[model samples]
Target: MPEKTIPILPCRTLQPVLDFYTALGFEVTYQQRSPNPYAVVERGGIELQFFAMKQYEPAVSISTCYVLTDDVDGLYQAFRAGLKETYGRIPTRGLPRVGPLKDMTYGVRQFLVTDPGGNCVRVGQRTGGERHHGPAPQETFARALHFASLLADSKGDPAGAAKVVDRALALTDETPTRVQLLQLLVLRADAAARLGDEEAAVTGLARAAALHLTAAERDQGRDALTRLADLRGSLRP
Candidate 1:
């Protein structure tokens, strides 16, 4: 089967966009550096890419992306549960309300979610579709790295966090997860700064800032830039 690619356009917050996908079980597959730095994530045969833009103003455009699955109902339940657990309310009750889980006329059972940036991520699995589920070999490593990074974050262990990131990089030749890499870099920056290696911290943050230098990434990278500056000021003698 031919691999499919989906485009993700975030108005200004690339980091949150990346976090949202990772939280939903997608794996980062590629990162581009030129002609614009973008990221590729894959779930099964479905691949999603981010098209970072300098300025993205919100609009009521119907940008839809399809996610393939073997259990549409189970997936929908998980999605609803996630929203409730994170926001303390059912996702169907308010703005960006969760749409119902129903079988479309086209033979796919799906539910829709409007991302914070206003993109619709449609999750679906075929009716009567048997669950042939497990992470791809590559995803297993990617998830491990992600989990370790989370653990490192909560435990204040930058060294351990860095190790996980290194493992993630090793799994894929190029992780188009610039935002995720930047985050890990930020963690490393904090870890380095705390451990008395101000130079390393600056270097990590600088690399992250440099990522935003592209036309598409300028605004996306600004948050990291501002954050780094704050760190720098705090570390000054």
Candidate 2:
């Protein structure tokens, strides 16, 4: 015996849904206008179906699907490329956006994608990690990143992530190293930018820039440094 499952989510309309999924390289497997408005899209083995509700609002829709895959990075890259090619830039920080890939404290590395219909697609791969119930009371750089990533990447709540990072920086007793500080500040800046808080973003990036690091430290934090640069580029007027 064999079985398969597909999510049928609600959308305000089907045209934008079709356009968005097609842009992400999902082929239109089926569509219908009779009986009711419906469409189906497929990418590899994954299939998603959408039903139209004329009065439905995608902004408030909480419909979602979980995609478990071994190649999280590859899928993210493909989606990112497709979105950028179609829109001339990848949309982030809002509906119809693809979030940056992140590894959470839990046993998963994932990316959050919000479709045009505001349905969420959480793509993740399992990794060895201690699954915890809630956020820890105490603050540390690592704990901060974990919590922030959970909000910003997993839940698409950059505002919450920004608050978490700010609280950690102001309250941490972990004595973070320069590289760690740089990483935290970069994330803070990113979250702020996503929230349309340009001043906070500038302040965070400037603070990160002011931190001194040895060559080895720079090498150790190349990823954060690169993101810092990208944030600067995005912040330009």
lDDT per residue as tens, model 1, 15-108:
5555555555567778665687677766666667776676764345456667778887676666656655655543331124445454343456
Candidate 2 lDDT score at position 136? 53
Model 1, global lDDT? 0.57
- CA displacement after TM-score superposition, residue 234 of candidate 2 (Å): 5.6
Q: Give candidate 2 regions above 4 Å deviation.
A: 129-139, 171-174, 202-237
Total clashes for model 2: 0
**Residue 40 accuracy (lDDT) in model 1:** 72
The TM-score between candidate 1 and the true structure equals: 0.43
Steric overlap count per candidate: 2, 0
Which residue ranges in model 1 land beyond 4 Å of their true spot? 1-3, 8-10, 29-37, 93-97, 127-237
Model 1 is weakest, by summed lDDT over 10 consecutive residues, at 89-98
Best by TM-score: 2
Structural similarity to truth (TM-score) of each candidate:
0.43, 0.81
Collision pairs in model 1? 30-176, 31-176
